[model samples]
Target: MTPKRVLVAYGTKHGATAGIAEQIGTSLREDGLDAVVLPADDVDDVRDYDAVVLGGALYAGHWSRKAKRCAERNADSLKHRPVYLFSSGPLDSSAEQQDVPPVPAVAQQMERLGAREHATFGGSVTAQTPGLMARVLVRSGKAGDFRNPERIQSWAHHISAELATLP
Candidate 1:
């Protein structure tokens, strides 16, 4: 049988969310799925995939607009497939400590898309990140990479297992 095709798309500023998406794609691949990672802006269709993973970066308690627009644009197609959502932000260990709920907009998107689940992963703000605020935060020793590869891989593998049980 052909491996399941999964689309892992993300909306990011300063590239943190993109990294998370890549990690998901890698993990899914390890689980024997055909995963493709792309920027949310470039995700024009979801009909070609068996499952979809959509994620975004959070800013001021709001999910990224790019991610929202991707979901809105692909809503009809996404609803027919098993869909998952994620958020990458919270430059702290809070996500590791507890289940962080999706922001309101993301919750609405999840309901609209019939997404199966949502995960919140910690974000990063390294010196290499672009933008004045990011640099300032890094310089102030206030920001660091909090994304955990183990957690991300665990989520992806879980998705892969769930997909195996689906029709």
Candidate 2:
């Protein structure tokens, strides 16, 4: 029996969302699935994978353009597969504390694709993050890396378990 192929694609600014996608891919692989992680811009098609986990970084309460465009471009194919959506943002612990519903755009995408679940993960912003706003936030002590590895792994494992039950 062949292992199921899963694609973990992300749209990120300053690489935080990519890191989350990589974590999801690793967890999926550990569960004995064939998972590949890629940048959203590079994913031209979803026809090759049995399932997909698509994620984006949030900016001003909006999903990244790259991520949104990827979903729009592959809407037809994605709708036919098991799909999960995620957003990486909230420089604070809000995401870990409670369910942060998807932004309006992401919600629309989730409905359009019939996604099984959506997770909102904490984001990162530090002095090293290039941007005047990031620097300002860092100076104000309002930015930090809030991504919880345990939560990410747990969600990925949940997806893995769900996929196991699928054809």
Candidate 3:
């Protein structure tokens, strides 16, 4: 049998989310799946892959515009495949501690698209990397690096395992 092909598409602002997507792809590949990581804007179609993992950075309680558009544009194709959604933004120490909510529009879209799973991961912030306003937020202790690599890898492995069982 041909290896299952998975697309890990993401939207990022400061690149933290992109890094997470790449890690997810790597973990999937290690689990004997074929995975490709790309920015949401770059992925023109989802029909070529057997499964898809869409993720984005959250800002002001919203998913990145590119990710939202990707979901909307490819809703039909995505609904027919094994689809997963993830949001990477919450400067909390743990995923459980995050008070952030999913973007309402995106949530509705995911439901309509028959997404298999959805997850929220911790995010990171750095005073040196962000702009002036973001720097202030980081300095004020409102933001900090809270991403957990182990958790990300574990999630990817789970997805790989699930895909392997698909007919």
Candidate 4:
């Protein structure tokens, strides 16, 4: 059977979220779903997709504005399909679940999107990554990468299964 189409959209300041989205898109395709990965700002419409995966880099406990806008702009179509939200943040080694908490921005749009799943995964931060301002912030201990590959793959699996079950 021809697989359903899935759009994996993401916003990233330092490429980490983009990388995550790539992994997710690849995983979905591998599982026999037709997945297209693109930057959130680049998606013109969500009408063709059977499912939408929106992801963004987290800074100061917020998802990027573009990703948020994508969700808002496509709210009507998204509500009629399966939607998933993922955020990247909380890289401090000291954080477990209690320390990292949850993604607040995603929470605000969850009900509106009728999101089937929401995930908060660790992101990557390197000395060479981020722009000047972001680098400075990271050096100042205000920003960090908290991406987790295992958790990402797990989430991908669940989403792939969900798409498989779609009619």
Candidate 5:
């Protein structure tokens, strides 16, 4: 059988979410799946694919608007196939609380578009580029890079296996 076609689309502000999406696409390809990574705003259609992975960056307890738009726009087509949603957020290292808020409305909407799984991953925060108030928050030790490559890799493996097994 031909490899399953998967669309891995994402939104990012600092580029971290984009990196995560690329990693997932790479893993899927390594598993012999036909995966394409594109910015959420750039993906025109989902009807041609067998599976779709929608991702976004979380800010102030909300998923990126662009990601939500992509999913919403393709909802009808996506619902006919397997769908997954992911978020890159949280500056907390401890998985116990992760200092992350619940999945935002935008992400929830994406899941409504036939998502089979939704995963939230820790992300990075930069002090040098922060605004005045954000810089103060960072200087006060309230910010840090909480991203764990191992955790990301594990999720990628799971998705890769699932996509590879699709007929």
Candidate 6:
């Protein structure tokens, strides 16, 4: 019996989304699956994995361009596999209030690729970041660390359970 291979691919600007992807990969591995975490741009083939979890940081209500392109380029292979999409953005505790909405174009692309699930998770913003805009956003009280590790773990657990039931 071979362990299921899962790919957790992500796109990040300040590394927040990458951290989330690593956590997901860790959780999946703990659940008895083989998981690899990689940058979305680094993955050129989805045919090597049994399942995929694609995520990206959302900026201005849009997923990272790299993630969008990854999906578009691998749509054909991804459609035949179990794929999940996640967006990490919004420095608010309330998921509903976050600016994590999937870009319309990206959402349509994911749908065409047959993604099974999509989730929006809270993100982090730091005041010491190099970008002036990021620093300003943090100083203006619109950004802070709102990531919920427990929630991320729970979602990963759910995915693990679902994968376990797959034929």
TM-score of each: 0.97, 0.99, 0.93, 0.88, 0.86, 0.93
Q: What C-alpha lDDT values do all the predictions have?
A: 0.95, 0.96, 0.87, 0.82, 0.79, 0.87
**What are the per-residue Cα lDDT tens digits for candidate 3 across 1-167?**
78999999998978989989999999999998999999999988999999999999988788888888888888889999999999988777658565445678668867988988788889878875567757878779787777889989999999988988889
Best by lDDT: 2
Question: Which wins on TM-score, candidate 2 or candidate 4?
Answer: 2
RMSD of every prediction: 0.8, 0.5, 1.7, 2.4, 2.5, 1.9
Residue 102, candidate 3: alpha-carbon lDDT: 62
Q: Give candidate 1 regions above 4 Å deviation.
A: none
Please identify model 5 stretches exceeding 4 Å from their true place: 95-107, 128-134
**CA lDDT for candidate 2:** 0.96
RMSD of 4: 2.4
Lowest-lDDT window of 10 residues in candidate 1? Answer: 133-142
Misplaced by over 4 Å in model 4 are: 93-101, 137-145
Where is model 4 poorest over a 10-residue stretch in terms of lDDT? 93-102
Who is ahead in lDDT, 4 or 6? Answer: 6
What is the per-residue lDDT of model 4 for residues 46-103, given as tens digits with 9 covering 90 to 100?
9999899999888778888889988888888999999998887666643335434446
Candidate ranking (TM-score, best to worst)? 2, 1, 6, 3, 4, 5
Give one digit per residue, the lDDT tens place, for model 5 in 45-146: 988888998889888778988888898888888888988888887767553244344375854675577577787888777685456745776888877776
Model 6 per-residue lDDT tens digits across residues 29-109:
999999999999999999999999999888878888888888887888999999999988877877655445566866886
Taking all chains together, the TM-score of candidate 3 against the true structure is 0.93
